[model samples]
Target: MEPLRTENLRPLDVSENLWDRIFTVAPLVIIGTVEGNSYDLAPKHMATPLGFGNYFGFVCTPRHCTYRNIEKSGEFTVSFPKPDQVVETSLSATPRSGCSDKATDVLQNLSVLQATTVKAPVIAGAYLYLECELFRIIEGFDDYGLITGKIRAAHVDKDYLKVSEVDEREQLMKNPLLAYIAQGRYAKISETFNFPFPKDFKK
Candidate 1:
């Protein structure tokens, strides 16, 4: 095969928003929390499991209710929506009206269930649910805060489970997952391939 041509890149202005240019594909999950007497669900794309432990973290802005609610209550739930539940996930991000409660409105429209270890709610038809307690909140990132949580309990749909006896690709095709492309895009991921590790790789 011919070697691909490469172009030397030059530094651009820092004022340009570079997140979209990075093209990171992240899992789209709805973060559920308790706000006053109501429940709040917000969709977050910049989330990932921290290290190999039971810690999960997401980037959140202080202006959002999710951050405030978590700060107040110290607990939250995470729902990993399936491809078919994209509408519900998007609905959770709807802005609140000045006169009415947004959380009440969202719960009335979407299907949710009470979490086991947390006081928050989780989307009912989601592929996975995680109940978490706030571990730490790291600030000093300008306007964004990194909220880390200690996962207390987790639940997964049997259909989406990777069984040792079953083929992984077949299971994924049966239950397509939802992915978020940064900068206002989403993908339904059903196809996958195993990573080709070099021979004699050490653990």
Candidate 2:
């Protein structure tokens, strides 16, 4: 590889948003939280595992009900939707109106199931589900906050599970995954390639 000159690089304005200028691939999962009498499902793109353990977290704001509900209930559910359920996942982000329940309207189009460990609901038809208990909420990220949880229980659909007997590439081709391409885009990942790791690499 040849070293390139810095003259070709374009500096971006940091005062405004920088993320929208580029595309990022992220996992899209529906976070479920319990409200007063019902549940609220919100699809979060800026979510990830805290570590290699049973910990999960997502970015949220105080203005959203999902964030406040998790504060009160101390529990939440995560549902990894399949590519076919993209519409339902998108509907879960319906904004709440004045004195109206946004989840109620969206739930009409989505099917939900009770979480086994957490006092929340998981979107039905999702390939993977996780029930989590509140771990901690770290504030002070501008208007956003990190809501983390300790996974109490997890479940996965058989089709999406990997086995020693089955080839990973073939398995993935048979069951595609749903991915959120940041900047308001989504994709169904069907084909994949094995990462070329260095010899004796360890996690």
Residue-wise C-alpha lDDT for candidate 1, range 5-94, written one tens digit per residue: 546765656787788576789999999998887789999998999988999999998888899899999999999999889899889989
202: Cα error in model 2, Å: 0.5
Q: Cα RMSD for candidate 1?
A: 3.1
Tens-place lDDT per residue, model 2, 1-203, is 88877798988899989889988999999999888887899999999999899999999999888899999999999999999999999889887772137867877888888999777899999999999999999999899999999999999999999899999999999999999998899999999999999999999
**Model 1 score (lDDT):** 0.90
**Residue-level error in angstroms, candidate 1, position 55:** 0.8
Tell me how far the alpha carbon of residue 4 in candidate 2 is from the true structure, in angstroms, after superposition.
6.8
Cand. 2 TM to true fold: 0.95
Taken over the whole model, the C-alpha lDDT of each candidate is: 0.90, 0.91
TM-score of every prediction relative to native: 0.91, 0.95
The C-alpha stretches of model 1 lying farther than 4 A from their native spots are 1-11, 97-100, 200-203
Please list the residue runs of candidate 2 whose C-alpha ends up more than 4 Å from where it truly belongs after superposition: 1-4, 98-100
